[model samples]
Target: MSEPVSALQGAIFEGLVKVEEAGPCGMITLRGDLASTQVKTAATGVAGVDFPGQGEANCAGDKGLCWMSPDEILVLCPYDQAGAGVAAIDKLLAGTHYLATNVSDARARFVVSGLDAREVLAKLTPADMSPAGFAPGRFRRTRLAQVPAAFWMRDEHMFEVICFRSVAQYVFDILTAAATPGSEVGFF
Candidate 1:
């Protein structure tokens, strides 16, 4: 008998592809409208490592961490560190006007890396992926395959694509089709 398809299975449809993992390595969502200074101060105090400023991506390196935004960040530490990281942030910004919600389980992340990564993205995204357009170390909240996703440019050939967990599979399928070999559609 044939095996049933699991919801989490990573399928290769066309050229667009998705990783096996459903969500990111780790994620934290921060909400609140605060002054830039307040947000920076809170983030710096909470982060064991340096925080990336606007238009920058901070690599925690051995610490296994990355900051996603001025108000939000994603750490790649082991599962055990998730709780501690959130707590530290909570403690540091105790008096600040902000809301921090641990959303590690709410979103899905896929590492789309390859020579054709940008090309595949171009199919679904309206943003320009050219070097002059979206440079490396940049990230943008955009739609991918008609799904709301945040695209983090890891390098010239790689991107960290994130989307909601519920529509992750659909997004993946769209990406696969765009990445199919010999497809004329250019994503980047």
Candidate 2:
């Protein structure tokens, strides 16, 4: 069997909240006519944490947590919890028609936090970054450097960015450059 790919490790930059490519963080994608019930029960059973509604984000235990959608949740847990977490959720949803898969390897996430975080995002995204515009716990699907990305506002000055593995690096570079002082020439 091919070895699993380890999370990305590299130089950490100051003023940047790099969400290192999370390890096999557990993921369960509930899909079915009654998926909402399964989602509610599973989320509540997980220590009374409520599942976020559509286009919302929720964090638990101070760890990097996010809800991708009403039917999908991304939990950042240690590698050992990957299987057990999914199993626990699956058990709670015994009769529901839901699908749970380990999708940690399929996506890449990064967080940019600092005073300039919103400014940096404004360089690329068309959505307003103001509190009234992109409130905390809210997420939006938008283009970043011309590539599709999911932008989740974690707080006033932090955002969780997710995109396909292939384009992650490109998107990162673009955002990083935009955060720099002189690289703001051509970005719109």
Candidate 3:
């Protein structure tokens, strides 16, 4: 079997906050009728989290489900467990017109954390990183500088961002620049 590798092998850069490729995160893209109880069950059951509403993520430490669309969710788990996670979903939703795909290798994940995480990210995206506008559990699919990315707050002081593996370096560089010390934007 091919061993898994993180996009940056957990590269860390300290600045206003901390930016690092956390690790290889397991991701499964499941497309189905979101309103269906069977699909909801499969998603939440796999993530050990509640079903999230639109533009929301129900995650704890990078493991849970992010609402991708009205008919899609991204299941998060340990990198090594993604294949098994897909099998579980397939078995759970058999004959239910659902599609569950392991997408772990297609993306990279990072932890943008610390007291200044919000300001650091706010400098890059158009999203309202202000506390009142983007609270915890809220998930947004938006661009970071130029590349498409998704992010959510694990809490008030921590955020998780994910983007295509092909642009991992770009994302990392942009994030680090946005967070470079002595360059703090006290916008938040």
Candidate 4:
């Protein structure tokens, strides 16, 4: 018996930017009224952080909450804890108008870092990625080179872009190519 291999195992391409899968992680999509106290309380209980406002993200230890829309927030945690995470939230909002669906396997995350990280993202997205604008603690659900994706800025130099599991390799390839030598993609 052997441990399961990563989807991008043995894949390494380095340049001014570095890209790697975030491995398995809990990704739960929570949908409910943003103003509901039950929603906020339950969300905070599981994520250890308050529900983020639109276009924002909050991190408390390894748990994070990324606001995806006016009525949706994505909870991120350890992969193995996804089921428990959902159960905890569901218990708290038993009768509320909320929906918590574990989307861990349906999605994939890629961490893009290094001096050229922002530049690499700039080539794929139309959203503002300037330090002054899309700074840390912010996230946006946007498209990356024609593929729907969401990016969370953990810091000025580190970001994690998430997309469907099916297109993860394609997404990686594009990011790798963008970071390759002579890509002509310039960092802001």
What TM-score would every model get versus the actual structure?
0.76, 0.75, 0.96, 0.92
C-alpha local distance difference test of each model: 0.61, 0.61, 0.91, 0.84
After TM-score superposition, the amount by which residue 102's alpha carbon in candidate 2 deviates from its true location, in angstroms, is 1.0
Candidate 4: the clashing residue pairs are none
Q: Is candidate 2 or candidate 3 better by lDDT?
A: 3
Model 2: colliding residue pairs: none
Model 3 alpha-carbon drift over 4 Å, by segment: none
**Candidate 2 global lDDT:** 0.61
Cα lDDT for residue 138, candidate 3: 97
Sort the predicted structures by TM-score, highest score first.
3, 4, 1, 2
lDDT (Cα, 0-100) at 120 in candidate 1:
76
Tens digits of per-residue lDDT for model 4, 1-188 = 54434456535567768888877778888999978888888778778887787889997656899999999989988777888989999899998788999998888788888877888888888988877768888889899998999998777788888899889899999989788877755658
| Candidate 3 lDDT tens digits, 6-108 | 8999999998889999888899999999999999998888899999999999997658999888889999998888889899989999888989999999999
User: Per-residue lDDT of 1-188 in model 1, one digit per residue for the tens?
Assistant: 55323334554343443333333345555554434565555444444456554555544532333445555555444334556767876776788677776665667767787777777787788877777877776667779857788776667877777788788778777776676667755434
Higher-TM-score candidate of 2 and 3? 3
lDDT of 1: 0.61
Candidate 4 stretches with Cα past 4 Å from truth are 1-11, 184-187
- In model 4, how large is the Cα lDDT of residue 21? 82
Error of 1 at 135 (Å): 1.6
